[model samples]
Target chain A: MISVLLIGKGNIATHLFEAFSNLKEIKVTQINSRELDNIPNADITIIAVSDDAIAEVSNKINNNFVVHTSGSFAMTHLKNKTRKGVFYMLQTFTKNKKVDFSKVPFCLEAEDKNDYQLLEKLAKLLSEHNYNIDSEQRKRLHVAAVFVNNFTNHMYKIGNDICKENNIPFKILGPLIDETASKIKTLSPEKAQTGPAIRNDEETIKNHLNLLSENNKEIYKLLTKSIQNGN
Target chain B: MISVLLIGKGNIATHLFEAFSNLKEIKVTQINSRELDNIPNADITIIAVSDDAIAEVSNKINNNFVVHTSGSFAMTHLKNKTRKGVFYMLQTFTKNKKVDFSKVPFCLEAEDKNDYQLLEKLAKLLSEHNYNIDSEQRKRLHVAAVFVNNFTNHMYKIGNDICKENNIPFKILGPLIDETASKIKTLSPEKAQTGPAIRNDEETIKNHLNLLSENNKEIYKLLTKSIQNGN
Candidate 1:
C-alpha cells in the first residue's frame, strides 16, 4: 500500500484527496496549508498549493519523497533537503465538478529515479495517461494550458456577453463550443480553424467588429491579424 | 415526403445534404450554386451559399418557400418573390468532418406563419434541437457564435502554436479544452472562469506575460484586462 500525505485546501488538493482516498491501495492523509508543522510521516508528501505559495509551503515539509503539484513550478522549488519530485496533473479543477481523473494527463518529474518511479506509480493509480516530463517541458505545458483553458473560457465569456446584449440565451452557443473542442482532438487546430479571419471575409469581420465594444474590437482586430498571418 | 432543393457546394450545404439524405421522410436534391437555373421545383428551396451570394442566388428561385442558410444574413436577403424564410444552423462545419446534425441547434425564421411552420417541420426532421428565432435574434446568435466558435477555435490555434514552439504535442491540451467547453453548459462562463486574471494574481499573470511573444503578449494583456474588468 502507498501512504500519501496531501497538503493545501484548494480545488486541486480537494479533488486529489477525494481521488486518492477512493483507491484501496492508497492510504491518503490531507491537511490544510496552515497546519504545516504537524506534518505526518508518509511514503510521499504532495503539496498542491497556489503558484505563489508553492515554495513557501514546500519549505515547511520534511519528508523523504516530497512532490509539489504545479505545472509551472520547477521541482527544485520544493526546497526539501530530502528527495523531491513533481506530480503535476494537467487540468482545470472546479470546486463543484466531479473530475474523472482517468482522463487527465499527469506530468511527473523527480530528482532521483526511485522518486520518479514512486510518483509514476501514484499517477498510474489515478490516471491512465502519464508523461515523464522535465520541469522546462512542464512549464511550457502550463502555458499551453493557459491558452486552451483560460483563454478559451474567456472567449466563452465574450460569447455570453454578446448573447446577453442581444437578449439571447447563451446556451444556444453551447453545442458549437463543444463541437469546436471535439474537432481539435482529431484535427490540428490550424487546420480546424475556420472563421472570417481565416476565410478573409472582410465584410463579415467588419460587421462583427461593429457589434463589439471598444476593448473587444481591439481583441478582434489583433486575433484577426494573427489568424490572417497564420501564426 | 418533403421534397427539398439545396443549392451550394460549400461545407454547410454538403453537410446538410448528407444529413437530410439520411432521413426517409425528406427527399433532398443538392446542386452546385452555378446550376441555379436548373433548380428543380420542390416544397422548399434552400440556398446554402455564401452570405454575399444569398441575395443573387435566391433571386433566381421560383419556389413558394425559399430560405437561405445563414446566421448573419436576414430573411429579407433571400430576395425571392415567393415566401422567404431563414434556416440557420448554429454550429461550425468542416469539409472532412461528419457532423451529427441532431446535436446542432437550428434557428428558423419566416415571413408567413405557414412558411414558419414548414421550416420548423423541416428543422425537426433534420435536428431534435430547433428554435423559432427571428432575423434580429439570429444576427445576434451569429455574432455570439463568432465568439464561441471562431474566437474559441483561435484560442486553440494559439495553444497549438505555443505547444509547437515548446516542442510539446498539442494533443495534450485536448482534455482541458473539452472540460472548459463542457463546464459552460452547466455553469455561466463568468462563474466557471479561473486563472490569474480572475484570481487577481498579478505575479502569475506577469510570469505568463513574460513567457509569451510580443504579439501574444499583446493578446495576453488585452484579454487579461477584459477578464479583469469582468466584461
Candidate 2:
C-alpha cells in the first residue's frame, strides 16, 4: 500500500486528491499549502501547487519521497533532503471540468529506477498512459503543450472573432474544429493539412486577406508564410 | 422527387454523390467536370469543379436551376441562363475520411425565394446544420475556417515537430489536443484560453521562447501577443 500526503488546494491538487482517494492501495491525505507546519508522514509527498510555489513547498516537506507536479520545474530543484521526483500530468486541469484520468498522460520523473518504478506502479493504478520522462524532456514537452493547447486555443479565438464580426454563429465551425483535431490521429499533421495556404491559391488567398481586420491580417500573413515554408 | 446532376470527381463531389445516392427522394448523377459537353437534364445542376472551372462548367449546363459548391464563388457567377444558387459545405473533405453529413454546415444561397427554398430543402435532407448565408457572409466564414482548420493544424504540425526533436512520442499529446478542442464546446474561446500566455507568466513565456527555433519564435511571440490582447 502507498500512503500519499498531497499538498495544495489548486485545480491539479484537488483533482489528484480525488483520484488518489478512490484507489484501494492508496492511503491519501490532503492539506492546503498554507498549513505546512505539520507535515504528515507518508510513502510519497506530492506538492501539486503553482510553479512558483513548488520549491518553497518542497522545502517544508520532510517525507521519504518528495515530488512536485510541475512540467517545467526539474525534480532536482526540490530542496527536500530525501529522494526527489516529479508527478506531472500532461493534461490541463479545471476546477469544474471532470477529468477522465484514464486518458490523462502521467509524465513521471525520478532520480533512480526503483523510485521511477514506484511512481509508475502508482500511475498505472489511476491511468493507462504513463511515461518515464526526465526533466529536460518534460520541459520540452511543456513547450510543445503550449503550442498544441495555448496557441491552438488562440486560433479558435480568432476564428470566433472573425465569425462574430461577420454575424456568423461561431458554433457553425464546431464540427470543422473537431474534425481538424481528430484528423491528426490517423494522418500526420503535415499530410492532414489543407486550405489555400498550402495550395498557394493566390486568388482565394487575396479574397480572404481583404476580409480580415488589420490585426488578423498580420497573423494571416505570418501563418501563411510559415505553412508555405513548412517549418 | 428531386433530380440532381453533380459535376467534378473531386473530394467534395464524391462525398456529396455518395450521400445523395442513398436518399430515397433524390436521383443523383455524377459526371466528370471535363465531360461538361453532355449536359445532364436535372432539376438542380451542381458544379463542384475547381473555382476557375465553375464559370465554364455552369456555362454548358442549361438546367433550370444551377449551383456551384465553391465557398468564395458568388451565386450570380454561374452562367446557367435560368437560376443560380450555392450549395457550399463548410467542412474539409478528405478522400479517405468519412464525413458526418449531419454535422456539416451547408451554407446555401440563391437568387430568389423559390430557389432558396429548393436549396434549403435539399440541404435539410442531408444535414441538420443549414444556414442561409449569402455570398459575402459565406466568404467571411471561409476565412474563419482557414483560421480554425488550416492555421490550427499548423500548430499541431509544429507541436509534433517539437516532440519528434525531443524524442517524446507525439501520441502522448493526443489526449491534450482532444481536450483543447472539446473545452471550447462548452466555454467560449476567450474564456477557454489558458497557459503562460493568458496568465502573462513572463518567466514561463521567456523559457518557451528560448526553446523555440527562429521560425517558431516569430509565430510564438505573435500568437502570445494576440492572446494577451484578447484578440
Task: List model 1 lDDT by residue over A1-231, tens digit each.
Answer: 999999988899999999998999999999999888779989999998888888888777778889998878888877878899998888888887899999998888999998888888999998888888888888877877877888889889888888888777787787898898898888888888887889899998998888778988888898889889876
Please give the fraction of native interface contacts (Cα pairs under 8 Å between A and B) kept by each candidate.
0.83, 0.86
DockQ category of candidate 2: high
In terms of DockQ, which candidate is strongest? 2
Q: If candidate 2 were superposed on the true structure by all CA atoms, what would the RMSD be?
A: 1.1
Per-model TM-score, in order, reads: 0.97, 0.98
> Model 2: which residue pairs collide?
none
Complex DockQ, candidate 1: 0.82
- Residue-wise lDDT of candidate 1 within B1-231, one digit each (tens)? 899999999999999999899999999999998876667899989999989999998888888899999988889877889999888999988887888888899888889998888888998986788888888878777877877877788888888888888787777787888889998888889999888888898887887887888888888888889889987
Q: Candidate 1 chain A: minimum summed lDDT over ten consecutive residues — where?
A: A139-148
Q: Candidate 1 — which residues are off by over 4 angstroms?
A: none
True contacts kept of 2: 0.86
